[model samples]
Target: MKDTLKYMGVVVVFLLSLASCTKKWEDHFGSTSAQKTLYELISENSDFSTFTDLLNKSGYAESLKASKNYTLIIPTNEAMAAAKADYDFTDTAVVKSFVGYHIINSIYNVNTGVDTVKALNMRNKYVEFTHGEFDGVVPTQSNLIASNGIYHVVGQPLKPLQNIFNLLKSKFFSTKQVEAIASFDTVHLDGETITYHTSPIWISEVRRNMTTESRKYTYFVVDDESYEAEYAKLKPYYTTAYEEGNTTRPDSTTTFFTKKAVLRDFMVEGDLSPETLAAGVVSITGTAFQLDPADIISRTKTSNGAVYRVKHLTYKLSDQIKQIKVLGIDPRGYKQNDKRGNIFFRDKRDMNGALYQDIEIYDHKVTSFYAKYRALSMTVGKYKVYGRAIMGLAGDPQTAVFTQYVHFFDPSIVAVNEPDLYKRPVFNYLGNADTRMAFEVQPLNPNEVYLGEVTQDVYGNMQLLVMCNGTGPIILEYLRFVPIIQ
Candidate 1:
């Protein structure tokens, strides 16, 4: 009977040890068998009930519950009420977007010494945490630990900033510019049945890229009144051709093309503020425009880009000259088929012992080289022409006499009466002994050497002609025409 009692005492001790271990684990973890996840922790907190409801409405509750290593910025019930006034929680897409902006995929532990921290939210936009604030929304408590992630209670709900397209739609409704742009439609005849859709296809193109793409862009938008005011300045010039049914009118100056040009000119390729935009902004059409302090109406930061509402926008005369690489120019202009007339000539006997492709203007039969530019849309002003050329052939004599001409279709004058502008005695080189040498040609007299000061008559077609006097073959390299914008 004594032995049986001792065995029973041993069994009791083992049971007591197991019970002690279970109590210790329960005290440390503060849960039954499993720890609370980020979603559950936020759901259980009374202050964050509004945020919990948002997660459920947005269909992110299950995602958060299943996800690991995340940080949730939960707003209080009062904060959510304020946000509900502005945001439509009934719209599932909007709710999803708003929730995505508050949740981050990575775990972020708050550092006491750090003043601010930037984290990328699930929406791919940045959410800044600064001094107990997450992107201007004050957080009441932070670093609430959970099994799957951490949660921070914020005083205000977070909203994702709209992209450029949406910003224009929301803010400029009264302007009618946004409505006119988005509502345009085009009809297509695919065989017999007519098919119609939106017109000005660029609107959809810009919208798609701004909303979905990761690339950034800067857009300058104006109200309908401002657009009309700007269009009035260009209407007188454009309407004349339309009335005459002039099919040959340059597309760049047409009413439709001009609108596209103006819109594209306002948009820059990157995110830029008015201060940075003043430095210089190049449009898609290769024109340059500047932003003045008075032009800015407002600026908004967006997820994919920035939008700047401007009072007025205009294209300035670009002093920037376009460079056409000599290598890319075609030499023969359908008039002659001679080897000497070729602008791009490949010579194997070059001094470097390698094949060389250089522009060769042979004087054998008045050979000519041409450079074309599309800067006739520029403001009426004198533009200076400059040239770089190699003086002589490898084994030929140096120096060559050449004449330069500036040919353009002057819209102000009748086609047959348009006068030819040329620079007489373009080059009177006093032969050099140095062979195969390169030199830059400058205008000795502004009147005698330039391509000629352009006038308002000039439109789009502008051509530069360099003719040899059959003196010798000249090696032409490149030419530049800089506008003298006063």
Candidate 2:
């Protein structure tokens, strides 16, 4: 009996040890067991019930229940109630957008420094995270981890700011004031062909390439009537910009110029105030216009931005479109190719800090030499013509005798009466003021030489000609046409 009892005791002790080992093994490995999901966590808190309902109505509840990682930047119920006026909770679309604004696709941590972290939200808009805060609101509570993802709580709801591009495209595109011109380029990346749309002019230039959420812009959206007014005012100057093979849209150039005229001067850098706008704003392009309080149609608030739809906006034509300056270095074609002269494009700066790019034409080896340049956007008005002709990067400026011709309407310059073709068409001496007008470029070259004043009869381009009777080289700089506002 004693021996049997000893064996029993050994077996019982062995069984106890085995049970303890099994318990420890289960505890270590079972750490992978499931816990509460992000939705469940939000559901547990009464303060987050508004967001919970939004997630459920948005159909995002099902997704958040899964094992995928997510980051929820949710606002409290009190916060939602305050912003309730801005949204219609009954609309499922609105609910979806609301929930999407709060959720991020990946796990995002709070920023530690002054630098901002632009986390893309579920709705494809950027959530600006700056110094542990997002959407200009610091989180009431944050870094709360759940089984599926992480979440942060804020006192205010987050709304993604519509960038200038988005605002311009979504709100005012129908006004026909701005066109999202699309151009595609195919690029090979690692033997794979990829294509993407190029940046439109509004985004690249007017917005100044500030595509980030950190930068704020106040876009003045012009009303349709005002847009047409500006277009009408600017159309006469852009008549000569011909678009070939576009017979269907004969006014394409005019329309494009007008659209640019409206948008280029409308965008201001910051969220300007009504008072400040009323006082007036100036564009970098030197366009100045003041807003009358009565002309403001409405002010619509955007995400950290706003769109002011206004009317009765007008600017001086000279201020709207700066004086036209054509560099002589770029010539369209020779007067006669068979009698072509040797030409060189040279660059230099004048004593007056003006650019004097030269279209040096010499060694023509012919009786007459003519180089033509097409000057577009010349309106039917008086112009003060200015010119500079000097040897660029050559030996010190020497005597250069050349006469210029400003031919309107017809660039062909068909000879009408003269028996000699070169002298007749090239000079255009048939009652044109600037035609056959001679100037000299001597060693004592002035920074700017007043060629003369000329009036444009037609609202279009002026075919400018640089002519020499084959006596000297054509050393010219630039031709500036300043409008003499009546």
Candidate 3:
């Protein structure tokens, strides 16, 4: 019994020593890098699995594995789902090609490479590819990492060679103005046909605040018959020639101009030059230019057109200002009242940080001087201003004019307490001027922020400004408000 106990003690000591040695070895070696094989990564992670399945079907799975160095852009299931809605995911060849393009043939782990390509709408310009559940992935979402490379789950595979032009055409076909220049085979240097599509872009390039980069577009002329058809639609609305001597509508019957000169410089030429379109009333910016009257009714097509970007919504003044009855307010708590009497008689106080002083405003009085007001067309809203009036209630009445404008402002200021009182108003007292403001109202998106301002003189001349502040564009219907006068 003694001998057996002594033997047991020795065995126990030996075992303890062995365990210590094992611990020491591990400490020196640190931890073995996770031996996550590529197969396991694909099989285990749903994102990778989806991608693998796609690759397999596309016959690109083996190729992906064979490549030693590659950047794999894996879209998340959510992204894939979105893509599927718009495109066909079942096509394996398409999937493989897209994956191939995304996979740069360089063996780069998460740490080895910088995020070269960017996702569609990521707040950050780029995302890194190394380490994380979804790093180094294309769509910036769920997928897994493995020894071989990264795996990402894409909702829809991308087209390998999609260009920016085609992408834009697909995204904005409804608003694009595309004309086949070939049809206008009889092209001349003179003012022959005013392609409505070309007119807005050309005019806007000169007058509107658009970057030169946006102006770089190839304008293909449309056939004569097509030009005539489009012209017939809006020509009637255009006020005929008011240029110096050769006034009245240029014989619409003529196709080519007898003389050749620049349209902008043509105004300087002899009275023989005719102004086929209205004088002085040019589009304010690209937004207000009504090149396509049909766009107001419906959104059609998805490909091809001229592209012009503008800061404010552009449409003619006739189209921008629409007349709308004051609809009951939304219970959500934004104020849209124009009670002038209360504003004039109430104690001067600040409501939501805006000065709310009751000041008497008179119409057409000596105080109300006729300023040479210019009405730039608005693209989305129906708005009208009687005449641009400066708030001359204090020293340098024009201070408020520069500080405050009657046009649209960012929508973020809408919910914020009123920053300035009566900042945007529609001047209504200008007489014999077109009083009827008309335009389509853009439906307010729940996510989009929109704010509009209109100011009125005591005589009731008013001006309005509206803008989109939130997620989407703001559409303005007819917004006309009469000042609540005593």
TM-score on alpha carbons, each prediction? 0.57, 0.62, 0.27
* Model 2 clash tally, residue pairs: 0
lDDT of 2 by residue, 259-370 (tens): 5555667766666778877777886456887778888888765554567887767677768756778778778877677644277776666656666567777776655566
Error of 1 at 397 (Å): 11
- Superposed Cα deviation of residue 210, candidate 2 (Å): 12
**Stretch of 10 with least lDDT, candidate 3:** 258-267
In Å, residue 233's CA in model 1 sits off its true spot by 2.6
Better of 2 and 3 by TM-score: 2
Off by over 4 Å in 3: 1-40, 44-47, 76-83, 97-145, 151-162, 168-176, 181-486
Residue-pair clashes per candidate, as listed? 2, 0, 55
TM-score of candidate 2 relative to the true fold:
0.62
For model 3 the local lDDT of residue 349 reads: 27
What is the lDDT for 387 in model 2? 78
After best superposition, candidate 1 residue 404: deviation in angstroms? 8.2
- Residue-wise lDDT of candidate 1 within 177-265, one digit each (tens)? 56534433322234343324434345543445556435678877776777776555544333323422223432333554335434555
